[model samples]
Target: MTSLLLYFLLGIISAIIGALPLGAVNLAVIRATTTQTILNAFYIILTAGVGEILLATLALYYNIELSHFFTQHPWVQGSFIFTFFFIGIYLLFIKNKINTKNYPKLHTSKLITGFSLATLNPPVAIYWILAISWIDKYIFELTPHTSFVSLLLFFFGIYLGKTTTLYCYGLWGHKIAQQKNSKTKLSRILGVALIILSIFQGIKFIAE
Candidate 1:
């Protein structure tokens, strides 16, 4: 009842916080809005939301197993480090890799790109795993024992919050596109920002 709704609202808040950050998926949404139509941006947003909620659901259901797995294999953490470093280097040193002009067809179908971008980001996956654990201890006690209906409500809230936040990012991208009309420059700036963010996170992971 009321307790179930609390899980829903917590899921929304957690999702908004997670989605607000600059990640590959948010950048994809921005790129779609800038290069393609808002409708295309929505397409990406929808798939991205699906991907995130899937991850969140997995995290919710297997929180204990996942935590145990990470504890058992510390080297798995280095995988995350490598991924962040690779993305940061590719974005910063590489020459306009995301340049949509070079691959116009790629932008035409944002569905796969959106899902790939969302699910493949190591940082996002780690965020969900860590977020669920932290929330279980500090915010709310989520466990496999939690009711299935409560988990469903939380998953729904995650989907709603993720798409809404990404739509807002699309709107911001559209505004910048209308004003600047320089997709390359905007993309490069966001790319650099993402690199900085990724590296910072990677370092944090190592330090932890």
Candidate 2:
């Protein structure tokens, strides 16, 4: 149907938006190792794709109110802020503790990090809230019969696009990591950025 094509185009746009940022997950992958293993990176990316699709699906089923609740709740917001603070401190202050003398292996635990990084980040959630809300309200609102199908297709497109972005970033990060002898500087910068962002968000949440 004509309506379906419009929704599909919208879905593609949402996918591009979601995939634009190289967030913590890819950053970690980049910092961890410097190897060109596209196949392995693709595997990790597949997991990320599934996570993104799941989040988008949930966001569509819910809406802005749900995202606002999570962002506004004292306990939830405080916990996330605290977690970010600690992670930043550890990465910045205790770089020696990470045993960077040797490259770390990406394993099952790292996948958990990927999932948590995607799910817990407020910005990611907010982006999904906006994208999913717009897609639902503007594109799928009139097509009652095609609602679920449209959502599924949109989610699929988003997952693929985002995953592809990560894979590309992985390649770049891998190459960069190999050439860079100093991780401390980059780690410090990233850590400080995280700390500042968390503090700003925490204050805003409290004020709200």
- For every candidate in turn, the CA RMSD to the true structure comes to 3.0, 3.9
- Name the runs in model 1 displaced over 4 angstroms: 68-108
RMSD of 2: 3.9
TM-scores for every candidate against the unseen true structure: 0.82, 0.72
Total backbone collisions, model 2: 0
lDDT by residue (1-208, candidate 1, tens digit) is 8888898998898899999988778877887788777888898998998999878877777766766776677677667556655665665567465555555453346888788778766556667888888878997677777788988888888889999999999999998888754665775677677677767876776677
Q: Write one digit per residue (lDDT tens) for candidate 2, span 142-200.
A: 22345777656666677767776787777765665555554565577668877886788
TM-score of 2: 0.72
Model 2 regions lying over 4 Å from their true place: 19-22, 32-40, 64-72, 96-117, 120-123, 138-145, 203-207
In angstroms, how far off is 47's CA in candidate 2? 0.7
lDDT of 2 at 94: 91
Best by lDDT: 1
- Leading candidate by TM-score: 1
Backbone clashes in each candidate structure, one number apiece? 0, 0
Cand. 1 TM to true fold: 0.82
